[model samples]
Target: MSRDEVLVSTDWAEQNLNTDGVVFAEVDEDTTAYDNGHIPGAVKLDWRNELQDHVRRDFVDRTGFSELLSAKGIGNDDTVILYGGNNNWFAAYAYWYFKLYGHSDVRLLDGGRKKWELDGRELTKEEPSRSATKYVAQEPDRSIRAFRDEVVDAIDNQNLVDVRSPDEFSGKLVAPAHLPQESAQRGGHIPSAINVPWSKAANEDGTFKSDDELRKIYGEAGLDDSKDTIAYCRIGERSSHTWFVLRELLGHSNVKNYDGSWTEYGSLVGVPIENPSEQQEA
Candidate 1:
């Protein structure tokens, strides 16, 4: 399909699961979910296995990313549909990873596995077939990602976003994972970040909120729809989902996800981390 022809409904995906040029991917951090069951014709891939390099705090190692995509029969031209057993949480993160790596013809399965299964869709236990394919890495859209240095500089004069829980943003609780190991050498947010949890873009069930509601929520957080915005979370996964919602769903013109997120930002040793709670209104 084309970039303009992105998202495919679960029904459309169900009908086209086995079609050529259509790649069905199951992205979950947990391998057991895929082992238990997955969409028919869907291939299982751990977020770390196919999406990120475990050793690298930021993203997939370039060479490893290429090899992983090729091993899964995913090529540059493939119209890939990604979903996860857990409400497409990891799938949305995978979608952003593919886009960052320059695969433009990719989309998330709306409502993901939970919705699909709730609608009585078909699932499979055995893995799907695969054929090797090649992908020529295209120049990445730097606007959708940020590195340590860039984030440090942006802290001085840019709209940084903390896509974590309000408590984390307030420094009330430390990160859940990456204990004692900071990804960005810092312990707080980029000096001026707005704390709007990535999950805020979606409802309790993982369905995204309406455009109007998104606008209101973001607006309330001091995010100008007309300005450039940078979002970050534990390790870029949650932030990527927010990036998608902001850039694609809300029609934001300039949005970037700091893929290094707090993990990379917090581990950088001297980068200042701001706790928004300290400045809360009386």
Candidate 2:
């Protein structure tokens, strides 16, 4: 899909709220907003419970993913419009997952629910249902995802980016206030990983930056299509947003989201570590 097709504006979404072949889905970190109110005819997708594997610390497998989407009444040919809080953090993560599973026409709700509410758009507690259709799942695409072993190979190549906040990247902040001890045994970043906070890719209104500005941001960070790029945050949600920017917005060919991220890398034994804060005191 074209870059424009990757994001749908509020105006477009409002007009197409009940349009045929379009399904509006709200992806949230939790179920509060959805339980209270949501876009009419929209389904709620919980990022943690539904999308993740029950046993492993990874995404749900192909069979599980297909069943979940099938239950949501989403189909292969339907266009999915996703939105959520935290500046569309989990929404972007869901978008990445949809692409990973080979969903043909997934699009992010530009500005997300926050912007939707700010605009005073109508939200309903009413839930709508469509006939459940079988959603065919595709083989998990590894090109858009980076594993621990892949990250190890990319470390020395300057292809890994820590998209956490400066404090988190520097090991000054272990984790966010809402969730603690979920990161890892350590606070520092992976050795050789560059720090570029994920929020830099968005505007004050939560819309993405312009293509030129986005290219400049990544370009100034020494990233191009020359080698594979791996992006990570604490648990990979924010990095998925960055993944969207690099791949969907910038049109880079070799970008991957390191879903294992800091929680996986920071706690792992025998891995190299770097603490710029520690070095600064020396």
Candidate 1: tens digits of C-alpha lDDT, residues 172-262: 5557443564334345567888888877787665666777898798889898655577888877778877888888787776778777677
Models 1 onward score TM values of: 0.86, 0.96
After TM-score superposition, the amount by which residue 181's alpha carbon in candidate 1 deviates from its true location, in angstroms, is 11
Best by lDDT: 2
Candidate 2 per-residue lDDT over residues 1-282, each given as its tens digit? 367889999899999998999999999978898989998999999998999987988889999999999999999999999999889999999999999999989999988998888889999999897888899989988779888988887887847888998988888787865566455888788887877898889987888888899888888976756878899998889999999988898887888998888889888889888987878877
Clashing residue pairs, backbone N/CA/C < 3 A, model 2: none
